[model samples]
Structures are given as structure tokens and as C-alpha cells.
Target: MTGSRGPAAASAWIPLVVTVTLVQAVLALMSRALPLFGMPLTASSGMPPEAVGQLSSATSLGSMLFFLWGPALLVRLPSIRQLQLGCAVSAAAMLFCAAGRWEGLLIAAFGIGLGYGPSTPAGSDLLMRVTPKHLRATVFSIKQAGVPLGGLAAGLLLPAVAAFFGGVDAALVTAAVLALVAAAALGFWKGTVDDARPAASAASPFRHLLLAPVRLIGLLVHAPRLRLITAAGFCLGVAQGVLMGFFPVFLSDHAGWSLTAAGAAFAVLQGLGVGGRVVMGWMSDRLGDPVRALSGICLASGLTMALLASIGPGSSPLWVIVLSSLAGLTVVSWNGVFLTGLAEAAPEGRVGEITAGGTFVLFSGYVVCPLLMQAVIAATGGYAIGLILAGLAPAIAGLALMIGAGRRQR
Candidate 1:
């Protein structure tokens, strides 16, 4: 049993990992392009503070809709079919964004968010089924790193495309083309979907939320240490979202840096995030406790973020770049650790349910941060206070994890 099972598991897992990673990378690139598009709209339309908040909320709203509905649908559809459909929808959405109409762009953003939302949980499910217990953390981390890598690629390449083409629309069109190609590739890949149906006697999504394992993982996320992890993620998202959402404005308003330079800098952060995930994952696997590794990373990330905030507006651009890269590294590492921990915590057959539930909670941070941070900035008249508050969130989260670790030890 052991001999045959080991090789079989490896074959099954490797392809799924590769496909999901590619899909995530492509989606991240697409996501990076949206804020660049929105910044100009905010500038040109003379959008009010509230309008800015709404625009930011639109992405999260789209994600929320997907988060709410995706799990139910995952049970009904085959994983491959779901992925294929998601990629197709994402392709169409990107094309819509490329069309450059205001209504079209909004629709595209929402559609893309909805499409991408299912891919993670669904992919995670697939990974869990195929990967052996011992290798789960390593494989999951490698897969999740694709997010940052994609974001990095988008950050670096999209702006250059926009510069050469002389408009954001061209970059959007390029992204659409890339997504379409990815979808095409996925369509041709051969694999069985990991379709673990909920028992016939199961309750609805809300009811499932109350199930023992699901509730345990959910509480785990809200646990003091995990709460800090989520909060750090929230702050990271805010910093990242703001930079992606409005770095052009920052460049134009405060720094003499051009749009291209600012965009590249933003991309650098995303690129570094890939390395962060790998380092964090390796540490988690070797240290034999994901929670502790996550806490350490968050602490490092929090300190870096505070340092970044302390670098005043007119400070050296090099300092901003350095801090941003460090923040990206530490901030993005938490996802892999947390997700793996949640999966590990689940009861056997309920892995899918627990993972999906945990992801729903984590994504809430993504949904809420952009809009909330923007609102705070609008109210406060300066980003300094907002950034400072954001920086502290991760530190608190890390401390929570330390306390939890101590409790578990005792």
C-alpha cells in the first residue's frame, strides 16, 4: 500500500499544483492592472472621497459575492470544469476591462473577482486530495506563492506596456489576451476533478458554517494570534491596495517619480512576496508548527511596515523601496501558513468544507481593508496615521500567536 500510494500521490498532486499556480499568477497580474486603471479615473472624473471608497469597495463586493456563493457551487460542479469556467469568465472580464467603458470596466472587475474567487478554495481542495499529509504545507505554499509572482509580473510589465502604448486600455487588452491563452491551456489539461459531495443530509452554507470542524477553524482564524495574522493581512492589503490603487497620485503629488517608476516599485513588492511565501513555508515545515512560523514572519513584517511609515514623505526613494519589499515578503507569507494550518486542523472528510470556510474569513480582510483604509485617509487628511495604525495590526497579531503558542504548550 505504501509503495504504490506514494508515487501515485506525487503524480496526482504535481499537475494540480502547476495548473493552480499558473492560474493564480495570471489572476494576480490582472488584479494589479485594475488599480492603475482606477487611479486615472479618480483623477480625471474629479471623483469625491466617497466615490473613491465606492470604487475600492466594488472589488471587495465582487469578491464577497463569490465568497458567499462559491462553496455551494464547488460541491455541484467538477473541479476542472469550475476552473475552466473561471478562466473563461476571467478572460471575458479582462476583455471587458480592455474595452475602456466605465460600466464595462466595473462589470469586468466584478466578474473577474467572482471567477477568481472559486479557484483558490477549489484548487486547495484539489491539492488536499492529491498531496500526502506530510507534504501539504510545502505544496500549498508553492501554489499560493503564485499570487505574489503574478502580481509582480503584472506590476513590472503592465506599466511598461501602458507607457509604450500610451494608455491603460492597451495594458488591459494585453492582460485579456494572456488570460485567454491561460484558459485555453487549462482546457486541454487532463485531470479528474476532486468532487467530494457534501452528504445528502447536509445543511445549507449557513448551517455548514456551524459544523464542528468548520466552526473550529473559523474560531481559529479569529483566535487572538490568528486574529493578528488576519489583521496584518488587512494592513498589508491596505498598504498594497493603496499603493496599487493610488501610487500614481503619490508619485505625482509628493515624489517627482514618474508613473512608470512608481509602477515598477509597486511591482517589486509583489515580486518579493513570492520569496516570502517560500521562506515562510520552508520554516513552517522545518519548525513543525505553522502557527509559530507565521507569528515570527508577522512580527518581522510589522516592524518593517512601521519603519516604512516612519520614512517621511520626502525621504529617500531607496528607503521606501527597501521597506516595501520587506513588507511584501513578511506580509504575504501568512496566507500559506494559515491555509495549511486550517487544512491540518480539519476532520478528514470535511477538509474541503473547513478550508472553504477558513478562506472565506481570510478573504474578508482583503474585502474590507481597501475601502476602510481609504475612508480613514479621507477623514484624517494624511496617510501617516492610517499607515501607522496599519503597521501596528501585524505586530498585535504576532503577539497573539505567541500567546496562543504558550497556551498550547502549557
Candidate 2:
């Protein structure tokens, strides 16, 4: 077993994780607030749905660009420095978002995406470099939990801030200020950690990502188990986007829950996801095969979501709460296992590239799922079909992972 280290070494990562988590949470809340901000812009300026989609996609596009190029750039720079740069960029993006102009919003989205995009792979690399392999899964789970934890924070806090302040713009500005503070903290943080060495001299980010090794890794990421896990992530993203996107409508029209209640419920659901992530990660570590743990969680989550859909509107408040909590737990629990597996499977010296490649593919699911869910809802006149379809996708993903795990065992 890898022995435990000194407190100074272990505690080194605490501040970084906390800052990243807070940034992510604030960004997510801001992202959710975009539609509200966009409504007036769309109504007055006649902005096309496609343009709105572009604005939404800007962050992902920036992330894609960063992931494709960041590995090589970061190889030369210290991980802490890279994180600081990312934080600065993210802060600037938020400032632009606060400007409240349509063009500014788009630019801000792109900036934020580019700035924060490298955090995932960069952070993962740092954790791997410092933490022992045996504890890697658990550490990663704790780190990954930040995503849901941030979501929960946004769910609970942003709405309250917005409500109290009389608009989301004020809340966004406040979030931006916080991001700036985090960036400052990152910039000044002093920690001693080894840096990853690159295999070759730097090349164009686009070229590096398209090369054989990276492409091969990207293809490998589609292995049955990984594919299923990624698909589950996609489904979860869809559920998140749609549930949050149309939440007010759902509450008023179907559930008869007030906007305040809906907001509170959404916060609770996201908060529960934090626990889910930790539990799933711990279980995966103890079970010795993260894939199996992932499969179980995905299967359970999918079925529970389906049941929630079946119950429909006007279900008991208690049932709604229970279903939402279960869904949160299962849906958000897959990332640690999936990501840790990807990190482990990567080529000896190309872990960053492999991680970037894998995450790029996985995030594609996020882009597609929401659009599909909305289309289904529009066509069917309710979320029932969409929810059922979403449920099945994860189950299929679970089966794929089970097969992949079997193959590995052999």
C-alpha cells in the first residue's frame, strides 16, 4: 500500500480544490441564468434560435479548443501556473458576461469556456502526480464531487441572490467578483508539485489533437464501458439542462408547485448529488473495479428516473423529493469511475492528452442531449417520452460497461 504523507503535502491540494469548486458552482449558476438574460435580447432583437444555440455552444467550443491544445501547453508550464491562468481567464469571462450585451455574453461564454476548460485535465494531472494510485479513485471522486457540489450551491444560492437583488445580472456580477477573488488566490498560491513532461516539442494544438496517438486515444475512449458511462453523463446533462431550463414551466403547469418551491427543490436535488458522488467513488475504490460500481449506479439511476416520469404531475411532494434525490445520486455518481478509468488506461506519458480527448468526447453528449430532449418534449407535448428515452440510454450504457468489464476480467 502507498503510505500516507505529511499534512503539509495533503493539505496543499485543499485550497485548490475549494477554489475550483467555487468557481465551477458560480459559473454553472451564471450559465443557468443566461436564458433569463437572453429573453429580452431575443424578444427585442429577433435573435434566431440558432444564434442562441451558438451562444450556448460557445463555452463548449472554447472547452474543445482548450482541451485539444492545453495538454501540450501545460506540459511546459507548471500545473499551478496553468490553473492560475485558467482562473484569470474565467474571471475575465464573467466580467464580460456582466456587461449585459449580447456580443459580450457570447464573448464571455467563449472566454470562460477557454479559461476554465483546462481545469479538469490539469487538476486531474495534479491529483495523480501528488496522490498515490491506490487512493487516486477516492481523491478524484472528492475532487469530482465539486462539480455537483457547485451545482447544488448554484441551485440554492443563486436564485435567492437573484430574487433578493431583483435580477440575475446583479447575482452574476457578484459571482464574477467571487471568481476574480478565486483567481487572485490561485495566482498567489505556492505549492511544490512535479510537472508532466511532454513527449515531443510543441505543435499546433489542432494538429496535436488530430495526430494518431490522440486520435487513437479518442477512439479507445469509446470502448463499451466508457461509452456507456459517457452516455450516462450525457443523459444526466440533459436531465439537468431540461429540468432546470423548463423547471418554472413544469412547476406551474404540471406539478402545481410555485416557482420558489421548484427552486428550493432543485437546490435540494443538486445538494444530494454531492453525497452521491462521494459514496459512488468510495464504493468503487473498495470494490476494486470502478466499472462495476458505475454500472450499478447507472442502472439504478435510470430506473428511478423512469419511475419518476411514470408518476407524472401532482405526485405526492414526498415522492417527488425522494425520486429527485435518487436521481441525483445515481446520475452524478458515474464521473469519478469513468474519469479514473480513462486516466489509468492512457498511454504512459500522454495522460493529459488522453484525458482531454476522452472528456471532449464525453462532453459532446452534453451538447446533444438537451437539444434532443427539447425536441422530444415539443413533439410529444410532455416530458414523459423524453424522460423514458433518457432512462433507457443509461441502462444501455450500463450494459455496455458490464460487457467491457467482463472483457477486461478475461
Candidate 3:
């Protein structure tokens, strides 16, 4: 095990990390594209702006379905090949979006999400094999940073491309081209990375697909460590989803900030989130306990989110900016550490299965919590109650994790 951390190992893991990061970044960009371009897209499609929500729902539906069956695909295809197929599907979907109408947008959004689904489990499968145990958390953090990186690129570059070509279609086309190019580039590494794929299952592929989610849930149910981390993932993911999904809206509605200012603050939060992931990962490595790092993050997230909920129109921009940055560090930065813990606890030869299952659990928070937040806002006619409850979730989870660890030690 010690010898596996040598220069030869470095040679392998470094490229794998870079490759996985690239895939993650591309997936993130594709997931965000339609929403970012919604104004122009809806205008041209003769649909109301609210239709974007329908498109988003379609995409989320596609992604959840893929998460359920992702492991079955891994059983038949190597992780790299799965990634390539996903990219190809995304590229074609983007093309459809660029060329077609409202119906096309709905179909394309779902396709893009389906294509994005392979990223976590497949990337984890590749990286877990080569990453050194000592550096696992930090490396995973670095790769996870690609998500924010992709968001940044979409923010800066997509608008420019849309403006330069005089339409959103150009932006869509450019993204499609990038996905296709990424797929082609990965081909060069397939021979190197695909050698360790599990033997193709002899069972019926459709049967295996239908049972994948059930099997994954069973794996999670029996593993106490996985169960704990999955709960943490869900709680933290709620905080994250609430922050990202509603931060700008909350600032505009309650904090009395202009939409532009709110967006700028949101960007600051996202930018800081990138740094937070790396820092937390490094801390996990130093502490030799990713769970401790996650606990601390959740605690901090709870505090900052509570403070954020209290800000009103009269609040200073400095307070809003500072709190948003803190939210980035706490709310948006937990994924890598959560994933590190997940990979570490996964059964041997079952990392992909466990990752897919855990991801499904975590992602459910993203779906359910936002709706809950909306409900709170509707009932109370204010954002504060919803935001505070969101903050409280991770705080409790963090305390629970701390107590659980202490009990295990005793």
C-alpha cells in the first residue's frame, strides 16, 4: 500500500485527476446552460420565462433517473467509456436545443441531465483507484473544484459568446462543440483507464438496470458509516441548495439589494466556494478525519446561514457580502469532504454503486429542500423562516456527527 504512493503512482493519478476534473467541469456547465440562457431562449421559443422552470424540472427528472441506473451501466462499460457516452449524449442534446423549438428545449434539458449523471460515480471510480490514501480528500476536493470552475466559465464566457454571435444559439453550439471535443479527447486515455472495469454482467441488462437503485439502497442501509455520511450529505446539500437556488432572490426581496448587486454577491459566494473546497479537503487530510472537517463546516454553515436570514433591506452591503462569502465556505463547500468519506467507506469493488446511491440521497435534498423553502416563504410571506430552518438542518447534523464519533471512540 505504501509503495503505491510513489512517482509511478503520481504519474498515473495526476492525469486521472485532471481528466476527471475536466469531465466534472463539463457536466456542470451543461447542467447550468439552459437556465443561464433562459431569457433569450424563452423569447425566441415563444414561451413564457416561467417555462424555464419546467425545463429545469425535466432535467432534474432525467438526472435522478440516471443516478438510479448509473451503476448498471458501469457493470457493462468502463467508467471512461461511460463518461464518453454521456458527453456524446450531451453534445447531441445541445445541438437539438440550438436547432429546435420549445419541445426541443424540454427534450434537450432532460438529455443534458441524463448525460451529466455519469460524472460522479464514474469519476470517483477512476480516481479512487489511483489516489493515495493520505491525499485522498485533498485530491477529491481539487477535482470537485471543477464544478465551480465550470460555473465561472459559463458566467463569463457564455454571455460573451451569446453577444458575439448575436444569439444564444451560438452559445449552445459552442457548448455542444466543447462536449464533443471533451469526449474525443478522453478516447486517448481509454486504453489506460478502462482496463480495470468489472467483467460485464451476464444477466439481462434491463433487469440489472431496474434493480440497480434497489441494490444501492441496500448497500447504504447495511453500512452504518455510509448511512451517517449520507445523512450529513443530505443535510448539507439542503443548505447548499437553498443558498445557491435562492440567494440572489432573497437578497433582492429582503436585503433590498438590486438584482445586479445580488448577482455580484452570489458570484462572490461561488468564487469563495472554490477555495473553500480545497481548504476543507486539506484540513480533512491534516486531521486524518474527513468527518471532523465536515462537522466543522456544517457548524459554520449553520451560524452563517442564521445570520444571513436576519439581514433586511436596511442592512449594509458589507454585512451581506461577508455573510454570503461565509455561506460559500460552509454551505457550498461540503461535497468533496462528503465524497471522500463516502469513497473511503464504500465496500470493495462497490465504490461506484455506493457513490451512485449516496449521490441519489444527497441530490434528493436539492430537490426536496427548495420546495420546502418555497412552501415556508409562501406560508410566512418572508424568507427568514425558510433560511433559518435550512441553516438549522446542518447544525443538528453536525452535532449528531460529533456525538456519534465520540460514542464510537468510547
Could you give candidate 2's per-residue lDDT for residues 265-384 as a string of tens digits? 666766777777778878888987766776787677678657767555668888878877776687666677767877776666555666676676655655566567667766787767
TM-scores for all candidates: the values are: 0.85, 0.82, 0.87
Q: What are the per-residue Cα lDDT tens digits for candidate 3 across 10-45?
A: 577787788788878787778667766655567789
- Which runs in model 3 stand beyond 4 Å of their true positions? 1-9, 37-57, 95-106, 248-263, 310-317, 378-382
Candidate 1 local lDDT, 1-410, one digit each (tens): 11124566566667767888888788767665676545665555555423444444565556555555566545566566666677677777776654445666667777777767766666777777777677778878887888788878887788888779867778877887777777777765443434344444277755653354445456556555445444444544544444444444444444556667767776777778887887777778898877777678767766765665565557788877886687678766567776787677666655555555565555565556666667776887655565566557667777877887798899
Candidate 2 vs candidate 3: the TM-score winner is 3
Judged by lDDT against the true structure, how good is candidate 3?
Answer: 0.78
Stretches of model 1 off by over 4 angstroms after superposition = 1-6, 48-56, 95-104, 192-256, 311-313
C-alpha lDDT of all candidate models, in order: 0.65, 0.63, 0.78
Error of 3 at 249 (Å): 4.7
Q: Which is superior by lDDT, 1 or 2?
A: 1
- Report the Cα lDDT for candidate 1: 0.65
